[model samples]
Target: MKNKGVVFTTQAAMIAAIYVVLTVVFAPFSFGSVQVRIAEALTILPAFTPAAIPGLFVGCLIGNILGGAMLPDIIFGTLATLIGAVFTYILRNQNKFLAPLPPIVANTVIIPYVLRFAYGEAIPIPLLMLSIGIGEVISCGVLGMILYFTLNKYKHRLFAL
Candidate 1:
């Protein structure tokens, strides 16, 4: 039991660290309204482990702070990741194809407002939604699905307690 807790903590910390690294390394495309946020690929992890819920939330929070995001972006962006991760975990037993949908939808819906109000972007909300939605599709849909497939092959070994 103690070992399980340790493993969970370790896994969450590792996920958070990797997310931060990916976001920072890809900073050019990890912020702003027109962003891909390659780190979002990790969002698919929730389909494999519940630890990803908190991991993603903390990672997004730290990532936003490190990326110099405004207050609203930090709070709301982190909440978006948390919401996506929880939903992904809840749907983990369903079709594998559905795993990334939550993050894609959450980010698409929430990030447009963040860009408009937080960053004071001049673009209209609908256009911002289109752009952010595109980025989320690329990040959480395309990349996340790819990751999901790859990790599915080693789930027991990588995620086992």
Candidate 2:
């Protein structure tokens, strides 16, 4: 039992670390006015374990800091990610295909306004939405489903949730 607990903790920590690293690796594409946030693809992992809650939140917090977000973006952006992660966590066990979608949608809807109003961009709402939403669709819709399928295949033995 103790060994199992240790193993779980290690895996959870590893997930958090990977999420952070991936966010950093893609930081340029993950932040700024228009971002794809390929790392958000990993948000689908919650379907495999509850630890993803903290893993994702901490990852987003760290990314926001390193990504150079101001107070409003940090607070609101992180809140959006947290909210989407919670939603993903709630339905994680029910449908893995749907897990990553909420974060994509949430970020797409919120980040555009953040870019426009918060960052002082003169970007029109619809155009901003188109650009940002396309990025998200590529990230979450394409890559998310890929990760979901890959994880789903090994969910029983590898995931341990």
Candidate 3:
């Protein structure tokens, strides 16, 4: 890609914007005890570009802030996304199906505590984990797989080499 720096920056910014818009548009399903954040499907983008690591982080930060998230949610929730994206980028060489696992695992484990401490939700941790895990399976597993394949075809054109 010509002007590789600009291309990478632009792609990352676009990914971040798309993530924020998707999360905000589905804000109801994007947060809380059982979250099915459709934007999480894009967590697979790191397989295509390292830029996705930061893109997902910034997008999640903005999403949590605009979703009326509390302090712990804002801090820890974004941290989860950051960790997930980094892991996803690191594991990019593995099977495409596995790329979304980090985000799924990270959020499944961390968000339950965020709910309990941040919102004082009365649900037990195990149940919250199960519910959140299931939602993540849908969002980051099923939907992420779909996005992976869809973008895989255009990745050569869409991302910096």
Alpha-carbon TM-score of each model against the true structure:
0.97, 0.87, 0.97
Query: Given candidate 2, what's the lDDT at residue 90?
Result: 85
Q: Best by lDDT, which number?
A: 1
Which 10 consecutive residues of model 3 have the lowest summed lDDT? Answer: 1-10
**Tens digits of lDDT, candidate 1, 1-161:** 44999889999999999999999999999998799999999999999998888889889899999999899999999999999999999999999889989988899899899888877899999998899889998999999999999998999999987
lDDT of 3 by residue, 27-126 (tens): 9999989789999988888888998888888889998898899999999999988888899999999887789999999999999999999899999999
Per-candidate local distance difference test: 0.91, 0.78, 0.90
Whole-model alpha-carbon lDDT for candidate 3: 0.90
Rank candidates, TM-score, best first. 1, 3, 2
lDDT pick, better of 2 and 3: 3
TM-score of 1: 0.97
Which of the two, 1 or 3, has more lDDT? 1
Between prediction 1 and prediction 2, the one with superior lDDT is 1
On the 0 to 100 scale, the lDDT of residue 20 in model 3 is 95
Residue clash pairs of candidate 2 = none
lDDT of 2 by residue, 24-44 (tens): 888879887678887787777
Pairs with backbone N, CA or C atoms under 3 Å apart (clashes), candidate 1:
none
| Candidate 1 residue 47 C-alpha distance from true site, Å | 0.3
